[model samples]
Target: MRLSLNPLAFGTAFALALCTSAALIGSGPAAACEGRTTLAQSYVGANKDVKAEYVYCANDLRSDVSTSTGAGSDIFARQNDVCGAACTTYCWTPSGGGPDPNDCTVIQDALLYDSENTGPLFSLDPATNTSMIVMTYNTCQTYILDQTNSSLTYCRSDWATLVNYIAFNCQATQNAHGGVCVADDQRWYIQVQHS
Candidate 1:
């Protein structure tokens, strides 16, 4: 006769499987907003002229205070008591769908205008199931004090550059990937299927 297996083993195995699945699913876009095309509503303005990620302030510094959690004040206090009168807050807000019919050519034209100074436009066919991701490097620093040593050190601001990089490439890549559509790093992809 076969020995009865322990119930605890089965429960543990099942829990492990569930956790693994959840981790994988969570890694991608959130379900609430997944598959819903999102447009870049930047502080600068929406790029309705071109089918591109809207330029939000374009590296401009913030004119007023942002967070009140004292993060800004703390950062300012440590930095030689100088947060400066004009500090920048680089960010994007979710708007609506990707580019419309006229967006494709418009964006291309805009890129052409800046072609002299920008990188080559990366494109891929939607049928290929690949995306062109843009990337860049930036550095910003705010001093912080250590509780144990009571010394200050520079914190990283690399994320600012990464945000800009995503905004730069996401639209073009999505346009190419979505059968000539628009998309962003937030995975807001909208496909305008060809007739």
Candidate 2:
């Protein structure tokens, strides 16, 4: 007799494997439903874990999505639109700065002179700020807004640590422009207009 199993069994196994990989990739506290769009889909965030993946359903596929990692809100809305099945992921770390002397000042000067107008890593609203920028010099961090005291803050432990790293290594003056940190809580959030 030949050993042949039902096709359904193979399909189920495949699905389970995919789910397992997705889970390993860092989904949210909840697992995503089969074929359903959700925030828990694999994706990357502004975290120190370089192996992290920023995955999610397409904007056309899902109106909401997020991940366990802490990424920038400025990027999240765009991620929904372009996060392929596997999602966009990358590894990044700051380097090449002095030991001290003028840490924040060095970074602030770079921001003002670099022509990029980088950002303010700190925030006035902790609840809203989820990401922090890297500092190039002594690396003392600051913010355009101070989220260290906000109500909507949802950043995770690792995320908070990452932000702290940015703050300590960057400049407070940089926080005066378009690049402000927004805290992500592993849950999909909708963009709200400011008054």
Candidate 3:
């Protein structure tokens, strides 16, 4: 009897081994977004065109404000106080400026927190997956919040720098794991993942 090895099976196994090794090494790109630290670091490291400060903004502060209890208005108003004159209540209005729901308050609060902190703010959420990162560049800032169990990545601004930063970081991280990143409707999707 003769023994033969299947090329396809062998190749798949080899790729899996490589991925497992890469993850274990811990020196290469992360296997997934994981948390705010990984996301913030990757974004800042991969993007150099924008001179910005990136930091993690845990959802604790936002969590206390209940959108269902009609506290959203109070919360937004407080955020507006933080943002001062730059904040606008009609961020989603067509006549205001496009359809981005993230207003100046969101960006300003993130930037303000970044300026006051030395490092990323750790999340208290049990999942530890729902987190955000604030990137402040020039006069404007934006938020990149990761959705739980969703491939749809959201960014606050339409600025080219902000958009490119997210796309570049997502693609780079996914590529390291043998995946492809695609951007559509301001959301990034990873089409493939290493088996």
Candidate 4:
């Protein structure tokens, strides 16, 4: 007597095996969500030592977001929009512009906190002439108040990071201008009238 295996059964088993292998090998869709848009802008005050760079991620479905400056040996401060979630922001300014003596790297990490509303995270108060960099992970959009121009500037991320981390830098500067200057990662600069 001769026995033959059912074609349907063999096909189903083969498909299941292939899917299991793909998942185990990490070839499946990503578990974390990615940002729909990213934005990075650098602002320098015309008068007084007020310089800052704002980076933002909007509609980010990822778990968290973080970032840092690229160059320069100056003190840096950062804030994010992870309102209720576990978030951490830190900066290590080497005594000068070079690698750390101890071979250490600056780190900004934002972990799982609340997944709902990310943030208006930072604030811009024209009355006080103060501005803050803000970021939001879950929300579809983010904004920063252009106090000098008396207008609202939108911010978002263009790509995604491991933890949905997005960041930029802000340094104080002294110049002279009546309007607001905006700079982005693409190196585009524009002046807005302070209305």
Candidate 5:
């Protein structure tokens, strides 16, 4: 498996933290049944060894629902919108510099925890304050955003790792104004199953 996370490795500290704060999420989706709008639901999360008929519920048929996958904040949220039964699940080392938030997914567990991220690997420059590197089958080699002007060059990993797992390619030329990167036309998408 490309990703292996043994909860034991997180040690007692992380566990204690999770135990102390996961009260809200522990209740899960069942608790929201009071006013839920689910319509003939099958299931939410995916299994490690299963790839059944990936369902697709339309916008008019569903609501913009979400669920938490980790501790209190800044972790990850599963978006269950236009996911066509949409959900993006991810589990890995809590690294600061990784793929774009929107690009990271775990819908097909095999693509994430089962493999070493088989797609365009884009990560913020870990060594610098401003920069992101892109790698894939596509031509865009990098996102050299260390200077005032940097563009997000795209990549297409042949193993079906498309941007948002859908786009063939993309670009977000942005400038670090006041030491913060700014791309007027770029944004991140986060969709996860509330299972």
Candidate 6:
């Protein structure tokens, strides 16, 4: 089951998930957007503790939000993609299609960019069953709270550097997993930036 998400849902659900129980934890990107072709780079050893799971705002194909209420399943929030000033996370797969509409456990912030203006930074090749996912961490917080988060700052202001950082970490992760992370019939490739 896949789900598209938004920050508003996470912000609103934060209290609910917290008050619910401790069992809520653990969960689980890519494709569509053909402006760039980025493959997984070598992962960094010093940054192994780094998390490479939040990559929203990269749009090639678009979808609405769904709920996947699971333990620790929020994809985290950020804004930059479709929600405009609002926030949303989009979880979609070419095969299974869009996510279940009621799932809110997975969170990824939406963005507001004219598909006509921005070209594409990533793309999904269904033939190879591969997708290059570009991620921005803490992006929504930076947008909403104006907090000092390095990842968000880097992503909002300087994207090239952020993309480089993401590529390096992605390589490192792929190295650990034999140069690939596979699920279903797809092989996932990633690029990301964070604090």
Q: Estimate each model's TM-score.
A: 0.19, 0.20, 0.23, 0.19, 0.18, 0.20
lDDT of 4 by residue, 1-195 (tens): 899998534533442332221111111111111242224444222221222334332322221111234411122112222122211212122212222111110111121111112422233332333333432322111123332212223222111111122122101111111111222221111211111
Best by TM-score: 3
TM-score of predicted structure 5: 0.18
Alpha-carbon RMSD, each predicted model? 19.9, 19.9, 18.6, 21.8, 20.2, 17.5
Best by lDDT: 3
Q: For model 6, give the RMSD to the true fold.
A: 17.5
| Clashing residue pairs, backbone N/CA/C < 3 A, model 3 | none
Full candidate order by lDDT, most accurate first: 3, 2, 1, 6, 4, 5
Worst 10 residues of 6 by lDDT: 140-149
> lDDT tens string, model 1, 1-195?
998976434433432332222111011221121132222321111233322331111121221222334533655434421111111222122222323333333333333333323432222222222221111111211111111101112101211122222233223333321121111111122222111
Tell me the deviation in Å of residue 11 in model 3: 40
Report the C-alpha displacement of residue 35, candidate 5, in angstroms: 19
Question: Which ten contiguous residues of candidate 5 have the minimum total lDDT?
Answer: 175-184
Candidates 3 and 6 compared by TM-score, better number = 3
Q: In candidate 6, what are the lDDT values of residues 144-167, reduced to their tens digit?
A: 111111111112212222222222
Candidate 5: residue pairs that collide:
2-115, 56-84, 78-191, 78-192, 79-191, 79-192, 83-86
Instruction: Kindly report the root-mean-square deviation of model 4 from the true structure over all alpha carbons.
Output: 21.8
lDDT of 5 at 64: 24
Question: Which lDDT tens digits does candidate 3 get at residues 1-195?
Answer: 999998534533442332222221112211234334533343232223223323333433232232435434544323221100111010111121221223223333343343335232322122444344444444333444332222222212222222222222223333232222222111222111111
Model 4: how far residue 178 lies from native, Å: 27
Q: lDDT of each model, Cα atoms only?
A: 0.24, 0.25, 0.28, 0.22, 0.22, 0.23
Q: If both were scored by lDDT, which would come out higher, candidate 2 or candidate 6?
A: 2
Cα shift from native, residue 27, model 5 (Å): 5.3
Over 4 Å off, model 2: 1-76, 79-101, 116-134, 139-195
